[model samples]
Target: MTSASVPAAFPRAVLFDLLTALLDSWTSWNHAAGSEQAGRAWRAAYLRLTYGCGQYIAYEQLVRDAAAEVGLPESAVRSLEADWLNLTPWRGALDALRALEPHCKLAVVTNCSTRLGTQAARLFPIRWDAIVTAEEAGVYKPNARPYRLALEKLGVQANEAAFVAGSSYDMFGTAAVGLRTYWHNHVGLPLVAGAPPPEFEAPTLDSLLPWLGRFGLRPQTI
Candidate 1:
């Protein structure tokens, strides 16, 4: 089946996943660890601790735990954590957000702690309408609480907004909550078994603007 098309009407707002969709955490990890294997290991450890174990630890703690799990030195862990505070935006992410800003409200619904989320937001060039962190919900994603909390805070129904995520698991979680989901599948990963698929898929954030435009939701021209 083809990816779901955008609705004829525009959503009231767009909710974005912070880590991979907006920020290039993997790039920073690779840069710090000096190997792709090290970066992947740290991410795996992080996913295991957060999604697999259902823990809501601080983002820094996750970094520390992952580093220890992968046998990284303290200096490397410290540098990685520092890099998180100044995460570089994924290519086209900032431009996409800026283009969409005036058309609809934009917010970050992330699985990061409040402190980390706040720091990450400061790095963004655009101001978000709302920011909902898992720290406030007491749970990581795929649990429904974080997604529901974001809907509540945005004053929008699940169907009134679209949730953008970069991972298949996150696509499943957001879809379970009834939001129209978009997957930024930059790496060409397959959907997880038994997980709900996203309504739209694009190789990069920049590509979604045209898809939205087809549904009469084009970005406002300055």
Candidate 2:
């Protein structure tokens, strides 16, 4: 099948949540700064389970189990969760993404091993057109399964769906699938040093709108 045609104004469905959208990099999770030590001594024991068991484990469950694993009671562990749980959207991101909510169907697609895309649904309000997580797709970003599932879930054509990915890999992924792609360009990752380029480049997530407008959008009829 050919790409779904772009509407005159904008895509009726737009997916937005990336790790860059929901959480900042340089945060401890990626750092693993003592995840092992923290997993053993910290309040959440379950945090280590994803490593030992399946990747789809819940952070909350990890938090709960980590507490028990580290010998802290669940109540005590709950007290320190605010400091331990640091995943949240970047600064100014909410307002920036907000500008588009009124204009189109906003969705979130994530490569997280868990339901991180949906978990983000609570922190930011986009009134999503759809939400898809890697666990459901059985593969990570750059893989066709997740992208395919996301398009199916969004009910939009490949061309109509502009994939906004923070990393080069995700950009390469969606573009390969024939969907328009936006490299959110947060960390200045090179474009795979000669890989096929993304359709658009955004210095920051805030900068993607004008570029996305090129694709056009339609009023969310539903």
Best model per TM-score: 1
- Quality of model 1 by C-alpha lDDT: 0.76
Find the 10 residues in a row with the least total lDDT in model 2. Answer: 43-52
lDDT, model 1, position 36: 81
Over 122-196, each residue of candidate 2 has an lDDT whose tens digit, in order, gives: 566556667777677655566666777878877777777777776666655676678677677665656754456
List per-candidate RMSD values in Å.
Answer: 4.8, 8.5
Q: Runs in model 2 with CA error above 4 Å?
A: 1-8, 30-85, 217-222
Candidate 1 structure quality by residue, lDDT tens digits, 77-143: 7777777776888898888888778777888888788988878877887888888888988878877
Q: lDDT of all the models against the reference?
A: 0.76, 0.58
